[model samples]
Target: MEFRAKTVAESRVETVHIIRPTDLNDAGRLFGGVLMQWIDEVAALVAKRHSQMNVTTASVDNLRFLQGAFQRDVIVIIGRVTHVGNTSMEVKVETYVEHTNGKRDLINRAFLTEIGLGDDNRPAILPRLILETEEDRKEWERAEMRRNLRAKQRKEGFHFYGE
Candidate 1:
């Protein structure tokens, strides 16, 4: 089947949440695990939007926690497709703390690789990504570099998880 190409804007996702006590860690800030889960969801939403297919996360790269968020803080998350491969797409997710003044402070950033899944639960072809702006183009180029680095690492027998 010929998949339709989708623009980065088409798959962009934004979500907001209030940090709760249950979502906090020992230091009284948002838990890292919870934040990671939220990031994963955002990335998955972007990939699914771009692919129009069920998707699963294949890998996560360059996850950087820049700051901590506390309880009662309004958190904002934005995810967008940076690039697409034959079967997978790269999604960049950014988490921010929104202030009452409508300003946002970035707290975390992560990139995820998600693969489209066919009805049979195997990898499926994904639609190509249309970069609309210079920023999008730069993101695509950066994604390409990350992809190539991952490939080289894999080729050199580097696996964080046991094969």
Candidate 2:
């Protein structure tokens, strides 16, 4: 199969949702898991757009919740493919919240690695990620470093303490 290079903008995705009471925690702030679900969904969309094939989440890195989003706030999620490998791609997702008073704050950021899958349920080749802007280039470099670290960990048989 011929793989064509695609720009980050070509596969970028954005989603918006309002934080409802059911989405809030006991403290009245948005639940982290809920936000994570949104992030993963958006990132998956971005990966699918870039790969044009069925994909699954391989891992999520550096999911940091910088701030909290209160109920009734508008949450905006932006996701874009940062780097692509033979059968995998890394997508960076950022979440922001806009308060009723019109104040905007960054809530969370995460990098998700997704592996494209073929009909045989094996890894499938993905389209190349084209870095068009300086920011895109920087993100690509960072994704490469993260990928290398993950490989090293796997090679050393690293596992979480509880696992």
Candidate 3:
């Protein structure tokens, strides 16, 4: 299958949000579910930008909450495509708290597997990911390992990935 190539920065996405009272849970901290929704959107957008097609979140793995966010905190979410297989791509989404001094602390991290949707809602062919920098290369390698682990969990049932 013919596939185009896209750089990691080509589809990179960054979004900022302010944690409001509504975003908090009964404990008065930012709700985990709300943050997950935000990151999920970022992942989908990254995949859509890279593939130039509609995308769906097939799986969310390695979701980690490192810290808690409070109301009135500025939240910054960044998403980037780490690796691409035939029809799917792994997107790493990071959530951080931006301080007044411009410092950012990582609050959460997740890797989402997004699959492009073609005509008739079938899995779509996607462009390849070009690893331009050492960081990008390392992220690709980590994603490969994650995919392999996931494949092992599924007993290698997938045909287009983790082989």
Candidate 4:
């Protein structure tokens, strides 16, 4: 069967937030959990914009903390939908540290996969992912492979129920 790719919908607002003491670790660095929370929050907003409904974090792939963010540093999170499938959306997210007060550099990068669910709470297909750039194409291929691999694993009884 022939099908078309579902390109990403325009996101309403690229949300931004600052790190507070509550979001920092005992060592005075931005906690990894804090970054994950922000990532999830932004990703959810993007997914909802595309899906027009509530969504949840289905999985996260290859999350790397390349550098550390201090308490006063601004952790900028950039998110976009890289791919979409029946009820699933793959969001590419990157974290950058804007610390003119400290030193400006990219602190981290990560890929997060979120699945859109219907009221019944099952995997729902949303849109087809359309790729343009060679980099976007590469990531789309990777997401496709991961999606297929995960589907195969699930069918083969490798349950990732909690994870």
Global lDDT scores for all candidate models: 0.93, 0.89, 0.94, 0.74
Checking candidate 2 for backbone clashes, the offending pairs are none
Q: lDDT per residue, candidate 2, 23-134, as tens digits?
A: 9999999998899899999999999899888899988999999988988889999999989999989999999997768676888999998999888889998888788889
Q: Each model's TM-score?
A: 0.96, 0.91, 0.93, 0.78
**Colliding pairs, model 3:** none
* Regions of model 2 farther than 4 Å from truth: 100-103, 160-163
Q: Taking the tens digit of each residue's C-alpha lDDT, what string does model 1 give over 66-115?
A: 99999999999999999999998899999999999999999999999999
Q: Where does the lowest 10-residue lDDT sum fall in candidate 1? A: 154-163
TM-score between model 4 and native: 0.78
TM-score sort, best first: 1, 3, 2, 4
Candidate 2 lDDT at 124 equals 95
The residue-by-residue lDDT of candidate 4 on 1-163, one tens digit each, is 2234445546422555677889888888889998888888888888877776678897777789887777666667778887777767788877787666655477766677788777687766675666656877887788788778888988999888694
TM-score of the candidate numbered 1?
A: 0.96
Per-residue error at 40 for model 3, in Å?
0.3
Residue-by-residue lDDT tens digits, candidate 3, 1-163: 4547999999999999999999999999999999999999999999999998889998899899999999999999999999999899999999999999999999999999999988768898899889999999999999999988987877856544443
The residue-level lDDT of candidate 1 at 128 comes to: 84
Cα lDDT of candidate 4 equals: 0.74
What does the lDDT read for residue 81 in candidate 3? Answer: 98
